[model samples]
Target: MKHHYWEAPIVIYLFLGGLGGGIFFLASVFDLIVAPGAGPLFFAPVFFALAALALGCFFLVFELGQPPVFWRVFTTKTAIIKWGAVLLTVAMICGFVWWASYLPLLGWQWAAGLAGLLAPVRSLMIGLAGVAGFGIMVYTGVMLSTLKAHAFWATPALPVLFTVSALSTACAAIALSLGGAVDAAGLGLLVEELIREIVHEVDIVLVIAEIVVLLVMVLSFYGAGNVTAQKVAARWVRGRTAPLFWGGMVGGGLLLPLALYLAGAGTAASEVVAPILVLCGGLLLRYLCVYSDERAPIPGEERYYERLKSSDTRFMTAWKQGENKY
Candidate 1:
């Protein structure tokens, strides 16, 4: 039985969400390791990170056809979805409380101050949230890998690929946000300095690794000759999705971003153009992956399936018809 192709927006969301969650996790780790008591600066990213994570989950829900039954996943006591739901809820509450305490309200200020006293507790919670977020980030990729239908996504490296892409995109998002604050000179400097000192160098290495993994994955598919995998590969090479797969995902997402970082663009740029490009590239990669995956033909049956008009619809109709006939 065939399935509808995963849509572009869903793919983009998956990529961005995973990347965002993973980055948030990484940031929490950083806060624990480097800036032990840095107050708002440390907590602000965590807040944004959790918020982004929740937003990503919303996208995933929409992508999954908005089934009424979907909520059942949340109710299952032993399900991973339940764990993810609980973790996300805790993260949101902790993040909001941590962030709200900084707002300049009269009585609220005092309340915030009182909440601030719980920083140590919040820190621990954020750390655990990071672990949960990381699981969610990697789970999406693992989910895909489990689909024996798409041999292209079956590799062990796919999960790691997703994780790396998530980190790269997350950093891109943070960089873009920080860059937007360029007019606030002091804040801009702090943002830039933090990115330069903490994110830039490490990201360069991460991007390199992402590129390597992508290359290896594609090559492995080429070597395998499985029709489904080849079809997915074609999307990256010469199909309608090729431009995004090659240009945006590879060139813009990995290569150009890395080049800019290595060229010292992070500290030197007055405008946010470079970081924005990276973010766009990351988003494009996600979009491309989803599009490609949806269109990917089943292995060993490409010719028979390729002749069918409206592959997705035809496939699904055939599936339903077969089920009814059976």
Candidate 2:
């Protein structure tokens, strides 16, 4: 059986982590900066970001084979593990502060007390979270790309693709949260138009950037001339993985959503649908990426197998000796 070490948990981690990081990231840079007095920043989007980040952290623990083993990430200087964790931890802390704005409504005096305690240093936390958020957004791709054995994932463009996708999904999540808050607040069309405009514009740019990175990753992987790289790229372009790769990711995720955003041209429903499609595409892309990886062939392995399959007694003797079975 083939050894595919990455499981569903890793996929989930990448999706949620990227998404959560992106929400916190965009919230710090875009929404918070632009909507200073807007309660939606505190009451909804930040809560959603925290929730997504927390869940992604859970998945990360799950993938560790044992939850307690998570500490090993910190105990050692494993760059990916240590840094990805720091991103999640810092983002969660900031998210909690922002999300805590709802606590008083729930009659939680403890949270109100905590909120007061946090007020003085809140801006610093948000800033730290944004830096961490940027790390969370890109680290998953970096983690995968560092696996030099997987020619499919070992590209610089993988991180770029993931970063763009992360930002795109984050924008979609924020738009949804803000939309709900707007309806609840009974805001007028003017507010709705502004939010929609922001979402539509940002999503289109992020989606376009993601598509470009994806194209570059795939083309470069195939064009590199490594037989293993060809096989990996073939999974997307010419092999069994094509349907989901092209259909789900390209069609449903990117192209269709892009078309919807452009065609709807400001319809609220289209704006909503556009993000959902992009979010779904991001998910499907992650799944395809984890599942389609074929580890690079071992050096001299193809030749060894070729000779072993031949009716060459000398090759058989050498193979048996190498296996210490002679």
In model 1, state the lDDT of residue 162.
Answer: 79
Backbone clash count for every predicted candidate, in the order shown: 2, 0
Q: For model 2, how does the per-residue alpha-carbon lDDT over 218-248 read when each residue is reduced to its tens digit?
A: 8777777477778878778878888888898
Q: Compared with the true structure, what per-residue lDDT tens digits does model 1 show for residues 1-326?
A: 23556765567557656755765576566656655443345344555675676676677677676655666667777655566556556555655654454443223555666666665476675676567667767776676776656666677878888777777666665554433312334764565466546666666677888899888887677666477777677657787667777777788767776776877553544125555666676666556554545335446565676666555775577677876432
Q: Per-residue lDDT for 124 in model 2?
A: 65
What number of backbone clashes does candidate 2 have, counting pairs of residues 3 or more apart or in separate chains? 0
TM-score of 1: 0.77
Can you give the lDDT of residue 104 in candidate 2? Answer: 59
